[model samples]
Target: MIGIDLGTTYSAVGVVESGFPILLANEEGRRVIPSAVWFGDGAVEVGEKALRRRGVSPVVTSVKRLMGRRPGEVDDFPLPLDEGDRVRVLGRTPEEVSAEILKELKRIAEWRLETEVRKAVITVPAYFNDAQRSATKRAGELAGLEVARIVNEPTAAALAYGLDKLGEKARVAVYDLGGGTFDLSVLEMRDGVFQVLATRGDTRLGGDDLDAALAGWCAEKAGAGAVDGRMIKEAERVKRALSADGEAVFRVPFVDGGESIEVAATRRDFEHLAAPFIERTIDCCRRAMHDAELSPADLDAVVLVGGSTRIPAVREAVSAFFDREPDLSQHPDEAIALGAAIQAGVLTGAVRKVVLLDVTPLSLGIETFGGLMNVLIPRNTTIPAKAGEMFTNAVAGQRSMSLRVLQGEREMARDNWRLGEFEVAFEPAEKGRARVGVQFRIDENGILEVLARDTATNRDTVLEIRDAAVDVDDEKVETMVSESVEHAFDDMAERVFTEARLKAEELLPAVEAVLSQGDGIVPEEEVAGIREAEATVREALDSGDANRLKAAVESLDKATEAVAARMVERAMEEALERRMGG
Candidate 1:
């Protein structure tokens, strides 16, 4: 069994051998494989190669953010393809894209071990909801591996940190800030058992946002028309340079209309641009500490995980906040994978000396009357737990009752994350006469399953909730309760139009900037076609037609597909030449 850290920016695979966990490098002898995928004409590329061709093809990066969200629920990202009610690329869902990455990792592990790899343990953010966890398991299955376990990232980090210090008792905080997710978990180690006290994080916040922050600053400094992929890459380089040096010089030649820019940015300047994001992480740390009911002084050690921790500002801030220097013994990039591998070992009986006990990050509940929340499993409860509630019809001749499952600590049902909803049918009888029992079970993987039993007949039936609709006002609830068959589609057109408008607002500037630089590079006819498509997009935007705007966006993407590919190729060549010359 291998342990896989399926991170947002990069992924790594590790294995336990001779009672110790070791990271397994990929075919290129690189331990960290960039979590990027590109859909080419005849082939699909992943890792570094896909990252290099990011702006050329339909590249999917930071897909972990989209794992559990419905296609319509997410509108911030640029996903041009659609498959029925879900987003797709080259006719592949997010799970399929993730499967490709996992498949590659599996291939590398198989090649290195010279054995058939069938089972593996994967790590995800502690705060990931049921939908996300289930989606991750599905991805692993699609990759031809049995997902032996789904471990929390911070819990895994704690395992990696506590493996060697089993004889010591300590309270440790694991700060994990990856490319697209942030999680702060507090754990206590005693004897040979590691117990997680609390975990908190934002799945959407991470280093990618830091890159965007710097890129925005760079765009403003360079007077660039927009923050494109190339600009983001350059900003990332400057960010790394500033980490080692006090200052770094940034230059971009012929950015627009034969104009070049050269600027020098100091560490202070970069920190200023990144302060908000850093502060956000610090806030999460404080909240986690509070949830764990401990002070900074109570922590025996603070362990940092993920590539973002390499930033000096981040490290300094964490040290100052925790009032002590963080333990740097474990490699930030490989610790989670190593810990996962150790957990896998425990499952396979390869490592029996250590035990891991993790907790749910949020409370699980169902909507009660008057828009109130009735929690079944409170937060921080031990995993693989089960809870059940009995319900009766509110009115006579009421055949069924709907339970809107929720996950969060909020008191109001609407404020919590809606896991899904299911209905239990009861025997026809007078008011409160029919009985039904609903069970909510969180398996070892932290995935939820709902089962309904007819108390009258003593029969059980499984219920599947596809779309987890948010809880609304009492009147809306009454309507749903009375209908018991179908829920109304409310404000769908307005939501779609708003989503389309947002996409157009983001894409227009990039299109304009690309066209601004395409005068000499792109063919005249192609440029003309792109300009026409752009006009159509503008018209759709003005007309407030979501479908029209979507069509126009697709047309524009098709028109400039070849040009974008060429531009990316040229940029790559120039970058390679610069490196070789240096």
Candidate 2:
């Protein structure tokens, strides 16, 4: 058995060798495979070869985002869906395209091991609905591998982290921002057991969105024409470069048939462009921490997973949110696959003494009176578990009742996703009738099953739902924290600017007064540095960027410290002179 990280942008296969998990390199000696498939000349190509044929052949990438997605729910679907809830990728189903990528990964593993690999564990985003998970499992089956388990990406990363730290008891928050999805999971490691306390995420959020945002922003700022696939690829390259350098140039040739567009953006500009996506992930982290009932101080470490976390801005954002630097102990791209390999090792007797547990991503419930959501299984509940609630007929002499099953983080049923509804036969009785018990059972794969039982006559009505309205509850996540405090972000930005401006207004005058008193106390080179800092502060003030202004003002304060000490000395000398004269 091997372990696979079927990612949105890249995929990898790993296995346990000598009780140590390692990712398998393919014939090309590449450990990571780009999650792209190209259909051209009646043949299929996968990975880097396919990614290179972006404009030539019909290439499909980020197909993971299209799984179980409606035509409108997602901003950009790699393919169009057929009538039967299937996507047609240039006559091939989305699953088939995904299967091709998985098949390549399997072949890589088989070649590395020099043996047949069948059974495997795969990882998915913690927020993936049952529908999406099922699609992934089906893809695995199509790839000639038996699906042994479906582990959440964050949980898998945590498993990798705890593989070497089994004896340490600590709480960890895994911040996973992959290519097409993002999830944050809070977990605890105790005596070799890894327990996920809570999980929160937005499936529609990830590095792809950041790339698109960067591409569009650069084109508009460069005064160039509309963006295209070429520009998007360039933006991705620039983004990767910005992860290491302070600034990078985005260049797209022949953007409008003749004119080439060139845009240079500092890391700060890119961070501003990427701020909204980061803020959304931070919102998810806040919810996950709240659900886990833990604060930043309570977490011993915050583990970063997925390729996007390599960006310096992303690391800084996570550090700010967690109040501590992220633990870069695991490879951002390979940790999930390696963790899955560890789990596979545990199951196959290669590894020993470890237990793993995961939690549901959202609250599950049914609609009650007045369109309210009555939560039966709250978000963060331990999975492979069951919860039940009792209800009665609302009207007198009712023969049956209709209930809408919902999943979300909202209090209103209408605001949540209606997973599906079912009709249960109710015994005729007066209002507030006999106890009808409703139970929700969720398995380790996050698939849900609902059962309604009549206590009076012991009759059971079962309803099984497989399809989700959308792959992610992005609408609800958008409102999770923003709606709670309307205009708070905008107001906070204004407040930040005002505060920074006030500091500059006060600090500049104080420095000038000291400079006017005398120049001997402050060195000429130091005086020149203070003037340069003041000019930089003024430039930042004119820019109207709160963060930049704040940074500049702080720098100026540090530069003028010598002058500030001179003011104190002069004041003391004047006091002594006045006393002597008196």
Which digits, one per residue and each the tens of the lDDT, describe model 2 over residues 110-138? Answer: 88888999899999999888778877888
RMSD for all candidates, in order, please. Answer: 25.8, 22.6
Measured on C-alpha atoms, candidate 1 has an lDDT of 0.81
Candidate 2 accuracy as lDDT: 0.84
In TM-score terms, candidate 2 sits at 0.78
lDDT of each: 0.81, 0.84
Clashing pairs in 2: none
| Regions of candidate 1 where Cα sits further than 4 Å from its true position | 78-84, 256-258, 465-582
Model 2, residue 508: displacement in angstroms?
A: 73
Q: Which candidate number maximizes lDDT?
A: 2
